[model samples]
Target: MTDTSRQFVLGKRPDGKPDRDTFELEKGDVPEPRHGEVLVRTCYLSVDPYMRGRMRDRDSYADPWDVGDRMGGHVVGEVVESEHDAWSVGEFVFGEGFWSEHSLLDGDDLTPVDPSLQNLSLPAYLGVLGMPGRTAYFGTLDVLEPDPGDTVAISGAAGAVGSTVGQIASLAGARVVGFAGSDEKVDYLEDDLGFDAGINYKTTENYRAALADAAPNGIDAYFDNVGGPISDAVFSQLNVDARVAICGQIALYNDEGVPTGPRKLPQLIAPRARVEGFLVGDYATRFEHANDRLREWVTNGDIEHRESIVEGFENAPDAFLGLFEGDNIGKQVVKVAEPSE
Candidate 1:
């Protein structure tokens, strides 16, 4: 057993895009679990776009991380010590905990991982068969509700959730168009992911014109992941009775101040479109159902997934900072420590 754990803590709030100084790495004593608690050794740590919202000192969907406190997110870890009878050593579990080598977790906060549940690697539980996949499942099928032959467009389409949304929509028999940051990502969406078309938002000079050309019949379903000019283009291409699922706004996540963009409500009015912002946690009761489906989809070649992993717990901060830079193609996670055999 180790007494020291390396962790990152909030150092200062960012004015724009965050950097290494935004976090401070420190070594602290490993927390000892009391009654009804267990000590976990982290194997992976997820760094997501939503984490940026928590960095702010304002009221939002999630609480802000206090300065000097241990930064935490979705952590997949192994039970190394247990003070609770319900948990045993060497068991794999997922929970919200600090970005450290080890953490003390309450039994209620932990979800046991069934190694035989899916054929994907253990780390797959942190991505495709995990939160991002589940978000895509509900956002595309449940919220957007695209139909056969309909054109479905996704902003931030190369990203974790957006990629999954596109694949799911394609599976539902819709023509999928994706707006990504790079030509390489555009190729990934079209060539590798089976999307009908992909637009490189970064390289395109006339986004609206490009989108209009791609979906001449108009977009029947829109999954908004990057809310900015790219989103505006998608809004302009909406068809009658279109459903728009607001999954994320990563485009404006690192803005220095409140971003003022073109108002798009007028675009939706005549089209009679429905727009809703959704959180994956809202469907918590049905997570198992979603994961099971995602597992089957990935395992059977019906769906494909990718990950941008930053090796070592030491570089976790850099991995998190890279999200705003669009450095990753899919789900971004940090490999902290290898799980025990």
Candidate 2:
């Protein structure tokens, strides 16, 4: 069926903080899928902090989005039409769902989402069960291997990956301490999520003091999400042989360049701490195991998650901007279209 849908095109590259002017929304005809491809009616589109890096014209671990190109993101959708046998019509799939109402994906690019979760919100595929979930899974268990009772500290605790990390760490028998931007987030981590300790870094004048107050035993494992003063504080408070999982540097994403924080490599060296950076995409082969475990946790009530669902595909640009400002409580997702039965 011929379809016309609205999609956001990157209007201009942002030098620093992105504004709505940076994106231009326009309507376009949904092109038919070629052989070995499927037409996915985009149900939900994810808005992640990582997408900010893509909008900038700079060198990074991931490629930048070209000018006038559709904003790239993860999306959960139904197979409206399929030219490939593997992807039948009405199949739920997750793949590169750009900021659009409908998307085309090669048979190789799409991964089938759990059919049981169809009745649930589609954004859950982009949040707890998707990249964010996988990131927290492997990043904690694999990258930051911690023993029972190890003191683990996580920054950006209110965010998708950070929230998942705290929950997983608590389940893994670690004394979890989380730092977030607001008092509400801190309350969410400590009261709602059962984190051992929570601190609002935005209120605290000294993060070092806050870390010391929360984690008296020193940090055994650090999940570095906001890489700024908070990171430096955690680095300084690391115990001997601590492991640091370098996730997204959300603090620096909107800046013109990497902000200069206190240099603390000496602290890492003295303690022989291992700091490792990770991307969930690198662990795609093992995602099944991670998802299986995450699914079990969710099923058993060991893990609880939230999603910031923004209605309308046109609101994608606003959702994307909200990430940097910490406006989203949990996983940020844009509802592109209703799921097709």
Candidate 3:
């Protein structure tokens, strides 16, 4: 095993969108696992839009990262050494791990990756079979609750959570309409993921007109991942009793102060729309059940998943910044290392 390890720390908190200067990569001795802890060699690191919110000094659902603190997120790794009975060397595990070549995690906090499910790649645990997938499953089925023939619309539709939510809503028999940032992503949503219609919000001059053409019946359910003008457009065209699941709001995540937009409450009143914001952590106790369903759908080819991987641990920060630029098609992850055989 290597005697040295490298990790990234928060160098500065940005007033707006963060850049590479916000991260500091430092080298140090590999940390040793203490009693009841396990040492893991990180193979894949997740880069998510929600991480942007965590960078702020203000409090949110997730704790804010203090300046100079090591960055951490969901990681898939191979256990290199273990002082905990539940884990053994060579086993793969998933847990909250640091942005480093290696991390020391409490065994109780880690979930063992099943070797029998080799049909799916290990990175799947960081995406479809993991947090994003479960978030989509619960948010679409439980929150949005689209009925058959419902016209469901999603913003930021090409992203990890947004893409998965679209597919799940489609499976529930909803005519899914997606709003994405680019033409390519719009094609991906309609042609590849089977979305009923897609609107390129960046290229389209009028979202209301686009929605009128795409979802002429008006929107029955809205899975909102981006909160901004796009959401404002969706809100303006809600059908009666429309269900809106407020997930991530990446559009305003980097703003310096209170972000303002069109008044939407009055519109909601006319539709009697139900809008509820949720964190996937709210359904922690039911994760196993959700995972089983997601796994079945994925393995049976009922659902298709993709990953946009940036090679090397050093580029983890770049992968994260790319989220804001809409650089990834599906899940954005960093390939840190090859797991030992």
TM-score of each: 0.96, 0.96, 0.98
What is the per-residue lDDT of model 2 for residues 1-341, given as tens digits with 9 covering 90 to 100?
55687888889998789999999998989879899989888889998888888888878888998999987788898898899989888789998767878888888888888777667556778988889999999999999987899999998988999999998888889999998878888888888899999988878998899789899999999998888888988999899999999998888887885667687787888889999998888998998899898878876788988898889877888888888878887798888777765
Question: Candidate 3 residues 76-141, lDDT tens each?
Answer: 999999999999898999989999999999999999887877546888889898999999999999
> What's the lDDT for all of these models?
0.87, 0.87, 0.92
Candidate 1 residue lDDT tens string, 50-149: 8888889899878898888788788888899999988999899887888888989998778788777523566677888778889999988889888899
Model 2's alpha-carbon lDDT is 0.87
lDDT of 1: 0.87
- Model 3 TM-score on a 0 to 1 scale: 0.98
Residue 317 lDDT, candidate 1, scale 0-100: 92
- Tell me the deviation in Å of residue 308 in model 3: 0.4
